[model samples]
Target: MCLQSDLVDADVDPAVIEATRSALHQQLEDAELIHQPDEAHLQTAKERSEQLNFAISSLRRQLDAQTRDVVAPRFDAIADTSPRVASLKASIDAITQLRESWARVHTINADIRSLKSERRRINKDIKEKSEQLKARQSLLGDLSTEFGRLLTSWNLPWVDTAVIDRDTFLPAVNGQPFESLQASGGGITTSVNLACSLTLLKFGLDHADVLVPSLLVIDSPRKAFGNNDSDRQRASEIYSRFRTLADAYGERLQLIIADNDPPPVTSDSFGKVEFDYDNPMVPGVSHPGPDHVSRLEETADE
Candidate 1:
């Protein structure tokens, strides 16, 4: 019966099934069963059960083989023993480092670009400043030449050459700074100061845009000179120079000199304000005495 069931479940050909049924009938007489079924269906039912069990066992073996093939590598990776996975991790780390390096390189390039731009701007500024300095130096040179000429005209023959200091614009007399001759006392200092003032005046006259006023006030140019021939000569020379400058520039320049004694020149040629002992420049106002105040009051009453 089991054989017949096997044949039927296997879906064998009808000819094979008939052959199996005959074989099963012969074998069934020797077979055993716990619950004896009706003879006609017994073999078929047993065959069906056997075939189903064999098919399930075969499918279980195939499923186990497939699971081993697909899941063993994943288990090895979980165990941290897969070479392929380690190589992939290394590749990922290398790529990440390369990306970080690229970012740094990009930042460096941007900084270089910015610094280059700044350098160009700074260079341009430096060039402009240099040009301005050169122009100022040229102007100072011209002024120094004019100052030297004026100093020579004022009878300072020692001041043959004059140069302006680049930084201070102060005169250098005969290739020496003006301060070098400061030990020569007030005469030399006063004369140099006057020469510098006239130099500025000349520069202002030449350059219309210059803000220098056309007026100069000197207090006692001959104050340092004593009652000696050399001092008297120097005083005369200074006054003569002043008169010459006034004549050359005419009303365009104004020079006011205040001294205890006047220059040895005609007062008619130049304006003069004289102050003597009787008509003192500073005349103090006097208050009236008591008798004078009483006389004024009596006059007011009359």
Candidate 2:
């Protein structure tokens, strides 16, 4: 029967083949499970650790070689480029600083021009205002006509005074002769002198657009009269006429007239400060008065 089965082995049962295969695998598993390790098996963990160390050492060598051969030379090349980069940065910063300075200069120049323009505008405004003031001042002349007429009628001979230099022309008034003569002369008559002086003073006051610093000093105004009662009365009348004119422009003008002596002047318009050198407060000859003390003392001692 065994010989007949060998001849038909190719036509075997599935369960029988599977059982045979499973039995062989189970024997292999059992044999592998029961086998004792060699010395090489015990050194497996050490061997793996040594292999890892060697790989790490080889990697370190490769890194060293790369650093020395490639990376170090490249680093030196990069270091060589740093100075030029720094110089370029410094140049760019300088250019930026210069540009800022130029911009500041332009701004200051603009401010100066604007200030000049404003100054010109202010000057023009002041000029216009000054012209307006001058125009307003010109209008005051029209009002002086009535004032002059009224002052003349009030016996004010100040307005009737005449001022004649070498070039002045005189016209005859009330059939009186027109007298034109040099300033320094005994040849000039008293009436002509009085008329000329009175007219000149009046015209000057009337035409004055602005005040001039001047003194109206009439020294010995009473000299126009002679040393008699009738002549003195005429002089008083003429002086009264002059005083009326002085009164008219009292606040705006000043008149200082002197005579040989003082009288009780009646005008309430002007102030009078009296001083008589001839009359002394003290009676003694050595001390005549405060003014004559020096002369009188010398004479008294002699």
Candidate closest to the true structure, highest lDDT: 1
Error of 1 at 211 (Å): 4.7
Per-residue CA lDDT of model 2 for 86-147, tens digit only, reads 99999999999999999999999999999999999999999998887666344333223333
- Model 2 TM: 0.32
Q: Clash number for model 1? A: 5
Clashing pairs in 2: 159-202, 160-198, 160-199, 161-198, 161-199, 161-200, 162-198, 162-199, 162-200, 163-200
lDDT of every predicted structure (CA atoms): 0.77, 0.59
How many residue pairs collide in each prediction?
5, 10
- Worst 10-residue lDDT window for candidate 2 reads 162-171
* TM-score of each prediction: 0.61, 0.32
Candidate 2: count the clashes.
10
Over the stretch 103-161, how does candidate 1's per-residue lDDT look in tens digits? 99999999999999999999999999999878767777888777777777655545567
Model 1 regions more than 4 Å off: 1-35, 38-46, 57-89, 157-160, 174-176, 208-213, 226-237, 240-253, 264-270, 278-302
- How far in Å is the alpha carbon of 39 misplaced in model 1? 11
Tell how far residue 8 is off in model 1, in angstroms.
63
